[model samples]
Target chain A: MLFDFAKSPIVSERQYDVCILGAGAAGIALALRLGRAGKRVALCEGGGLDYEDESQEIYAGHTFGDPYFDLDIARLRYFGGSTNHWGGYCRSFEPVDFNRGYLGDDFRWPITHDDILPYLPEACDIVEISSDYQDRLVDEELGLRQVDFKYSPPVRFGEKFQDEIERSKNIELFLNCNFTDLIGADRRVRSVKFRNYADQELELRASAVVFAMGGIDNSRQLLWMERRHGARFFDRDLPIGRYWMEHPHFTIGEALIKSWDQANLYFALTEKMQKSLGILGCGVVVEEQGDSTTKRLIKDLLCVAPGIGAWAADLAGKKLICSYRFHAAWEQAPNRENRVALSDRAVDRFGVPQSELHWRKARIDRETMLASTQQFNAFMLRENLGRLQLRDWVYQGDEYPDDDVLAGYHHMGGTRMSSTPRYGVVDGNCKVFGAENLYVAGSSLYTTAGYNNPTLAIVQFALRLADHLGKVV
Target chain B: MNRRFFSIAGFLALSLGHVPLFRRYFPQRIKNGWLLKDEDV
Candidate 1:
């Protein structure tokens, strides 16, 4: 049943098999899966049915390094979460992402890719995308592989599953319910407390509690909880908000190439090449331009190399040449310093400290994009297909331009999964290190962020977490 | 016929014909589109 916490009658205490905070992709997926299995679920959403400026204000905070979107605007604060404004791009993480031991312990995931492979079909069904992913190896030597991505009609969880959740016999969705704190002791959560806009409070007791809050808030709330309650809730030593990551997006350069069938194709280096080059994953998108752009590129080329420019002009006349804008969205290696911490001075209306994100691109991040671009350049030169004219900043190794698409707004890591508490916050099953009944679900639990969009993998992990919570609860 | 003049003119014409090849050997250095040298690649 649906109940707006602001309007619904006050219930001092309620009980459920599982209490899931946040009704975004992860929370909704987990709640639906558990409800289908006849488990009582309390799916709590911080925001109401639609967007509200007051509700969004809670996400406001400071960004210390790099040019980033304001915390409040980076993600939506309504029922469907950020899915309300997602681009619908979907691709699963490659096996190399999970088993990257060569990159170091920080890059390794406790679980293998095979562990999540079984759930791909169901995850694809949940997101309304095809399960088949066709990847073609374009050049074996250069390790250039043309990857396939499935686009969703971009399912908004709130719009699509509202009726089902409302009609669910075992699920109770509470909108406009903001999580305040957990009331428990001895590393076992007994109840969760939430307050509505009117400051009316409600407490929910559940055998299991899952924090499916979006990537940043998961760490922000946990950090606040740790500061408020100390080691009473969970291990205090676990990195609460460290190792945060993002996929940096930049228009690397322009390219002139012979007309090919693959026009808006995604390409990434193979695992072997990544290991050889000592770089992370990078996805390059080649967007073919029209005749006007081709002519413009020929004109630019004519100013530099007249011979190649004349040849390119001739090719353009014959309709054999194509101009492209090469863009790249690459993975940022997890750095302990790049983290989300609580702001010392600022607090929300509820008096909770706001999130202060410390994020910057490392040298390896630049190398990852540069290496991928160089590989593409080599492929073009080797095949006699085209030439790549890199941007001045890229070739010169200057600071990343602020005007470009700075990032994909794909927040990942922070409350990452690892085998031990020293390396990460959650275990392989996404259970908090010392907390028995508390678990985390979302991209925040990602051990390492790959170049693909996090929504598909977020649903997969939610489904997986639901399966785990099913047998226990 | 002036044989010496003819030889010089013929030589000049041949050199002119191979100007494109000389241009190929010493290509213009453009600021953008910086191609990686063989060793760098």
Candidate 2:
């Protein structure tokens, strides 16, 4: 049953088996899974059904190191979380992404791709997409190896599953409930402190606490807890807010494709080639230009190459003049320096310290982009597929283009999972080390940010955590 | 020597300028395995 925290009378003490903070994709998925298994869950949402100006202001903080989106605009605080604006491009992480050496460092997923593969169909169903990702139906004659991405009609969890959440006997959703602090004694978390939009203070006691807040908030809360309680609040060597990653994406350049069929081949990567190259996930998209841009391109080409220009000019009124804008989204290796920390100066209206993001692209990230684009350029040229003019930064070695480089809004890795406590905040089971009952259930727990969007994997991991929690609790 | 060379060079240039012929026969002979189409640009 859904309850508004502001409207409800002050309860003496509320108790549950599991209390999940932040009713986003991860939280909602976990709540529903556990609720089905007869565990009482209190799913807390920071905002109500729609967007709120005051709630969003709480996310405002300073960016320290790299150029990044304003903290306020980067995420949403509403019931469905960032899924409210997610582009819904879904693809699973490749097996290579889970490897330790992929990033050439200590970073590695304690869990393998196989561990989450079984739950992907369920995750796809939850996000309302086709479960079958195989591309056998795409004609091979197109010369493109079909890479599958199931677009979610973009499910807003609050609206899509309102009935299920409302009807569930075991789940109680608290709207306008912002998680303030974790109340813990020894090694296990006992309860959580929260406040409503109206600043009504409340506390909830639960056997297990799952922080399903989005990447930024997940780390922010943990950092805040560690600061308030002590250094070893969660664990003795808790790497609570480190190893942050983002899928850095930009338009690398333009490719002149005489035919759409020829250009499509360069757009997607085959599994065989991806494995052979040991690439940590990259996708190419060929976006067609509009009429005005097409005319300009043809006019520009006519000055030098009259043969192709004449051909292009003939089709000005007949068809779309095929100038494909080449876009690439590549994985950012987890960098410890690129992290989330509590701002020493800033605090929200509730007097809670705001989060400070320190983000920068590593040298390896630039090298990988260069290598991948060069490899693609070579392949296209060899096959006589098309002529590709690479962006300036790609040809200019060693330095990443700082001017217009944008992240894919995919925040990952902070409470990264590891078997050994020295490297990560959480264990393979998503439980914070030393804190037996506390678990994290979002992209923040990701050890690596694969090029694919995080929503599908977030749901998959949440479901995995639910199954684990169901068996134990 | 100059006249003879010029005549031969002009003939070769004209023959190579035949894009249709190059599209039809050159790909099979070159064997570089590029998908050469016999269509307009």
Candidate 3:
């Protein structure tokens, strides 16, 4: 019984207390949080529910630390956004990622890990992940049992919270609606415009606007608006699409022995390791480099008791059910050069300019990978746990052995959050500088957290924004 | 006769009634057309 805008082209777009664009993890979570507080919320999204776009295309790609598999970025463009395609890997950002002055590129967020610490559990509820309000299990916080468990049930938001979304009286979701721009009056956003495949445009008037699109579309929409309206961010050398970052993932080598019995690890042990292990799209572990830090988080490598995969087919009685876990995510540094920008040329359907994303890794990024690989190999050897192997394709050219062969799925840091407007476009609360009521919620707000999946942190941030809006509204 | 006129990708080709635009040099329109291959399927 949700407000289904499945067939209709034009949906209603009137003024509301809050307007959240992109019904992905951030948008939907915030809508539910604010709606529960009795605030009228308008949740606008370009794609319809459940990865259900007929115009989608599929292809092959790599995820976490695995070989290239058949994947599709285009298959995602709907109400749920990319959350449908997510492998349920969930992890929180490490302390080192929240920088005072980011190592290379922009600045750190206006807020800190402690700022959003109180809202983690509420965020977890929205994601359907069993979590405490403050998931601070690691970092010698209280020294009382840190992050002993991990949760990511391969959950898809479409079916997971469809009922909850439908039942909320405060939230009104308009699916099949694509947000085009934020019409501004003075310093605040006056309204938001969107359309369905039928080519009908609808605009919503609001007091504040929160952008919740996925990494790619989020920047695409901002860049499109900037080009069309000539916003303040365009001229200031602010790193909008620049400093694009992601955790490079792929299995380097495998470890198998002559006497290998069944004894593989399902989820990593510590919360730091859990967050950084790159599983459930949650928690990341922090490792200190010679001068910096590193983490390895790749999702979707099933680790059975040990000889599990080897005997998965042979075991007749017990269906060799090998539980999958994301391997690792090497910490990635910021490079001003690796970015996505509006190609002076390309334009999309609604006369908005298309994004020409030029994503590439830097030398420091490769160095970190090599360092982690060597450290990991040594760790496995010292423990005499299991045979360790690195995928051949990943060890070739420093970091990106084969640029065409590797993966860049965990897109991060574009309209990066920083303390100063000169450093990044948005502040810690994700509000854009010089503009009030315009906030961005996504991985794009990260300064540099080294290969950590951003969904968990963003959920916390979305809920936190709701708390702030509650007091003000 | 116009190899330079177009290129095709997987995402756009599957949509029924939608035709993809692979402009060799310049894009002609933003309204991408769908494919007419349900008959072939």
Candidate 4:
């Protein structure tokens, strides 16, 4: 049943089998699975049914280092969480993503891809996408493979699961109930506290508490909790707000290929090539440009070299040459400095410190995109397909252009999973280390962020977490 | 206004005046492999 926190019956304390702290994609998926298993759940959301200025203000914070989207505008705080505005690009993490021990201990995920494979079909169903993914090797020598990405109807969790949650006897969703903190002693959370917009407070006692909060919030809330109550809750040494990562998106260059038919094509380097080059994962998207763009490119070329440009223009006029824009969204290696910390001076309406994100693209990030582009360019040349012209910023080693897409709003890695507390905040089961009943869900649990969009993998991990909670709770 | 003569002149200008431009922007023959260095021309 759904209830507004401020208007609900006066229950100062309630008890449940499991209490999920954020009703986003991950939270909702886990709640539904546990609900089907007849587990009573308290699914709490910070915002109401829609976007509200008051709730969004809570996300307001400061960003340091490279330019990034405003903290408040980057994510939605409503019942659906950020899924309300997500583009629904779905792709699973490759096996290599889990086996990156060579990069460093912190880069390795505690679990393998096969651990999440069983939940793919069910997770794909929740987001309304097919499970089948087709990948073809376009160039064996260069290890360049054409990859596939499934588009979701872009399911908004609030609208899609509202009726089901309302009808389920095992699930009770509370809106406008922002999680304040976990109240516990010595690794066992006794109760979870929340505050409504009206300053009304509610607390719930559950056997298991899962923080399915969005990526930034999971780390922010944990950092705040540690400040208030020290190592009593979990391991103090855990890297709770470190190793944050994002997929750097930019228009790397323009290309003129021959006889291209697809509107968009995705390409990535194989694991072997990535190892050989000592780089991370990268996905290059080739999107065909219109006739006007082709004409403009030819006109620009005409001024630079009249003879070849005239020949190119003639071919374009005969519909022989195809113009394309090359956009690449690649992985950023996890850096300890690129992280999320609570602002000491700025606090939200709830008097909680706002997130202070420290993020900057590293040298390997540039090499990942540049190296991937070179591979693509080489493919075009060797196959007699055509040529590519890199953007001046990329070729000349200038700073990233501010006008282009700086990064995909895919927040990942704080509270990342690892085999031990030295490298991560969460264990292989997504449980907070040193805490028996506290767990985290969402992209925040990712040890390594691959080039693919994170929503598919987020849902998979949520379902896996639910299965684990079923046994314990 | 002979089209053939203008085309020849354009070709000569491109071949002589734009060698560096071609070497910089255009596709070159991949002799060793496709994985060019970070400073790939």
Q: Write the per-residue lDDT of candidate 2 for residues A1-473, one digit (tens) a residue.
A: 88888687456376799999988899999999999999999999988888999888888988877677898988899888888888888887767678645445556678898999899989999999988877542323322344667889888887898799999999998888888887778767788888987778888899999988889888888887877787434676577789888988877776555556444432444444545545556666667766676666667655545555576676655663467777788888788788888888989887778888898887666645545555555555455545454555554332456666488889898899987777788999999988878899999998888778889999999999999998777
TM-score of chain A of each: 0.99, 0.91, 0.75, 0.98
| Two-chain DockQ for model 3 | 0.01
The order of the candidates by lDDT, greatest first, is 1, 4, 2, 3
- How do the residues A235-262 of candidate 1 rate in per-residue lDDT, one tens digit apiece? 9878989999999999988888896876
Candidate 4 displacement at residue A267 in angstroms: 0.7
> Fraction of reference contacts reproduced per prediction?
0.19, 0.02, 0.00, 0.00
Q: Model 2: runs farther than 4 Å from truth?
A: A12-14, A100-102, A135-145, A231-233, A261-279, A298-321, A397-405, B1-41
In candidate 4, the residue pairs with backbone N, CA or C atoms under 3 Å apart (3 or more residues apart, or in different chains) clash, namely: none
Lowest-scoring 10 consecutive residues by lDDT in candidate 2 chain A?
A: A136-145
**Residue A68 in candidate 4 has what lDDT?**
95
Q: What interface root-mean-square deviation (Å) does model 4 yield?
A: 10.8
What is candidate 3's lDDT per residue for A44-162, written digit by digit as tens? 76666655534233111222232332334523666666677776656576454564242433535566778877887776666667774234332232111223234567566666777
lDDT of 4 by residue, A1-473 (tens): 98898676437456799999999999999999999999999999999999989998999999999999999999999999999999999998999898778988768888999999999999999999999999999888998999999999999989999999999999999999988988889888988999998888888889999998888999999988888888878888678889999999999777667777788999999999898878899999999998887887777656654555576677887898988999999999988888999999889999899999999998788888877887778787677576566777776567999889999999999999999998899999999999888999999999999999999999999999999999999
Highest lDDT against the true fold, candidate: 1
Clashing pairs in 1: none
Candidate 3 off by > 4 Å: A1-6, A9-13, A50-75, A99-107, A132-149, A232-237, A256-328, A380-405, B1-41
* Residue A244, candidate 2: alpha-carbon lDDT: 84
lDDT by candidate, in order shown: 0.88, 0.76, 0.56, 0.87
Worst window of 10 by summed lDDT in candidate 4 chain A: A300-309
Give the CAPRI rating of model 2. incorrect
Tell me the DockQ of each model, to 2 decimals.
0.08, 0.03, 0.01, 0.02
